[model samples]
Target: MTQTGTASKTVFGVPVPVALFFIAMMLPTAVSVNLGGLRLSAYRVVLLVMILPMLLDLVSGRRGRAHVFDFLVLAHCGWALLALINWGGVAQGIESGGIYIVEFAGAYLLGRLYIRSYEDFAAMARAYVGLVLTTLVFTVPEALTAIHILHDGISGAVGGPMAPYIEPRMGIERTFGPFDHPILYGVFSASSFSLAYFVIAKRQLMNFSGMAKVVGVVLATFMSASGGPYLVLMMQGFVCAWQRVLGDVQGRWAALFSLFALAYIAIDLFSTKSPFHVFVNNFTFSRESAYNRILIFEFGSAEVARYPLFGIGLGDWVRPVWMSDSMDNFWLVTAVRYGLPALFLLLALLIGLVWTVGQRKNLPPEWRRARHAWAFTLFGITVAAATVHLWNALFVLFLFLIGAGAWLLDAKPDPKKGRMTQASFKLPFRPAARLF
Candidate 1:
């Protein structure tokens, strides 16, 4: 008898997963490993802990193919096999593959395990939003410092061999703002920022209050100087246009949302105080680096042409053919490293997800709206992935959760003696869902 509402069990009645999730979600402090003469980040080191639960399950009790988690596991296996085969060129094939697995895949799975119910989902949403906010909080100071350090507006940040591959063209600093990198931070901001828009837009549709936070975060993302985020976010607007084409939900707000998105883009394009300029200064100002991404993209296409079957390999990004001395633009990276197959898998997963979510005909109206935004947000994120890898962990994790969560709720609703059982999965922590 599965308990309804809150107070329901998570993962065989253990509360540790949620706690573990919090720790894992915290912005990691520096740490690394010492392999003889080599050292790796402590953050990377802890990533391994995330794999234990899944690994144990795989070994202890095998599950049938009907399981939702199975696909995620399959993707990782494919990634591993690709890594092994391509070896990313033994010359510089070295990357924190283990850490990449744990940190990137681990975080997503943690979200899934902990976000088992509706309240949990809300909590998860808040937690994810919180991270975005956290990044923004730190970014204010970081950007200020970065500005002073690099002296923004004076000239573009100087580009060196270690600078962004595309910086030579754009001249923008692409400042990190307390994140690992400015471009990475911007990508994170854009992904979460898009999610925030989803929330605010839904609120408008529902006549709910809380548009303030989304406004603030969107502003913060603009300051990150990462061109990819700007480009991806713009794509979200295009997606909303497509959604309107699908006729999922028709109303003034839908059109208004589209209009608002366009207005934002227009303003950014003309704004002279380019956030990109502040960060990259020089990288984006030049035509050479501006066009370099195309060259790199071509590089990937050539590699794919030579090896169209399987990719160079998944784990070997730093290898000569794929990611060697290049920046991450989602489509090219996937095509180069794993060949065409990996990129195809990505498209298939995204399309399949969009279809499943769009088919949720039984959820409560509010839940339906929430899921709609989820799908649209994903659409934007996928487009953004073409230019940024933030989708790798932070954004992609949420997408997987939505897909699995929707699948979990597809069964017929429980008809209580009273009102119809909530047509959604209630979280373990929501006040209404709470057991206490």
Candidate 2:
């Protein structure tokens, strides 16, 4: 939906600033340096490198008046740090909590500062597409052979593999690419589905290049062979299709919401399991996985009840000895790891941003389309997080996208040209900006 423009600043054709973040995420976690007992991975290093400039932008009010969402993010990070300190003591807390701050708040600030307009958002999407496509070179083969070429190469060079080898599922190898798990890779790829479709495809279903990007996204997600990523793709696909078919209908989303509420209520009344349990059972790859997640919610909530203010931090959660330590639900894990306040702040940030962006009015057609794409992507991800846990790079990326969409709230309509322009922010760095 972005208008044609000169190319933006790029490194080897990918957009800068955001390019730095995406490139760092694409690298293996094994690629890191242990500096003074703190391990700085590529993404962490990039976040640290860019933090000062981003803070300067925020302090200067170059981006815009700070919104409640901004404070919510900061508060979430603060509470998380406090919880860690409460559990681990000051020194260990700072060491661990500092990493979360850099990865979460730092990545969010990068998106908030750098992507300040539609063109900027488009450039970010293009950079993501390029990165996903590049990874396909290794992912596709890894999926087929179960021999992670990129990870193997990095492991050999770095002295060990960061991600453990996952056994094949349904006779096909689950490929994680550079991430620590197949679900993370799948989620990373699936997050781009709507962006590629609406921004790259430009709402034209028949457009070859756009469709190619969509197909590529699906292929990459499929390589992960994980139910969580598959769920993301399906949710985005359904939302995109609903938009396409009902774009002309007023209150369509409201009607859809009503229908969903009715279905949820009906399921809650009739089904022996709660709606969430039923949903998880139907959606996962196996009943065992679904049952485990149910138990996670049961025991995980009990733990939360015990430590309501500051969670157990990195300490082990109470569960059956037979149960694995892994907590698959991201939202639950946040509450379990930190506290309810931390989880509440995060949910508020995510839901608040999505609501504010979607409620913006009088946008030009292009900007409106872009808003839908961004909002829909986040919506799918918000739901997907309940089914899968996000950590490391994927977690940073999830927060980054929330920050990236904040610009939409500040878009003002230009009366003279009947176009949408960023409010209170001037383009600080623009170098010729092309999407393709």
Candidate 3:
């Protein structure tokens, strides 16, 4: 349903639905219940609770025109389930596959339905900034003390530890916050970098509060001490700088793409290792970690080649005895677990959304800025996911962000003038008191 007035329902300056999603994500995984054989965590429970309303909105056309990415998401879920059923029996397959459907499709539909306007998106960005600030209170201390306060407290209240202790790196502990892993925590924090700077800053890049938001995000990211999150921060920072400096230049993005292509070709032609191998080696934290990822890619791709259709499912993959069973790469893991089609559909949804949203014309300056922010955020995530595996909250949040951008596609221009509309980018809440 459309908002009644100029503003939407909000709590503490954040949209109600957006705040709910953030709260669900921040909840400790320990706060969960087992249903039959399935374990449903806090975020999963939230998704389950919202599924009916989301479906009804979709059926009634209240969410507006559906995009190809929506269908791709559904197809990805459907094919994944079919493949799982083919590998395992129907009962086992449904049991395993249903979890993914709830996590991916459910979170995605929430974003697609509730966040249907500029006000909602801006509120989401503001809520994200607030989340980064709040989490920093836990992440900084956790990084120094090697004790995750929020996670430990929740686990203690629930009678057990939720996550295993990760050893310190570079004479300091890697911060886990309330997430499953330090990298996930870092990636989640890093996702807001572009949003905070581009969307929150609006027309001025050096706005004081906007810079504070950026610093908060950077601090939270550094607490993770993981290469994946560091890469995201660096990439997003570079893109932001590029836009600020050369935004008026024609074909700037095309030039950047061409330069990357040239570099990839040069590395492939001259280097002994493949471009992908070199990329993995250079972007990792330690020599051992780099070598391990290289071996994983080498072996994981082989497994995908062996089982190109339905994948091996729960069966053990053929890897060296010394190699770890964990697959660090999310894209490779998807291909290895559910076949190439699953990966293809996911890639299509991601690439198609970014491309289509960027290509939209006649958007106001505010909408255009938000589009760029969302695009670069996804761009960094796409590269980072190739390096680290994402699961649970991180995965659901990724899908939700994608769905939240669907409103850009259906945005209408000034029909009478047939040109860009000039709309003031003002939030409904008091800027000075609420934003900072």
RMSD per prediction, one decimal?
10.0, 5.5, 6.8
Candidate 2 lDDT over 343-374, as tens digits, reads 99988888777766776666778787788878
Summed over model 3, clashes come to 0
lDDT of 1 at 317: 35
- State candidate 1's TM-score: 0.65
CA shift at 292, candidate 2, in angstroms?
A: 1.1
Model 3 misplaced regions, further than 4 Å: 1-9, 13-15, 203-205, 413-436
The 10 consecutive residues of candidate 2 with the worst lDDT sum are 427-436
| Every candidate's lDDT | 0.48, 0.82, 0.80
Best by lDDT: 2
Candidate that beats the other on TM-score, 1 or 3, i.e. the better one: 3
Candidate 1 least-lDDT 10 residues: 427-436
**In model 1, how large is the Cα lDDT of residue 72?**
43
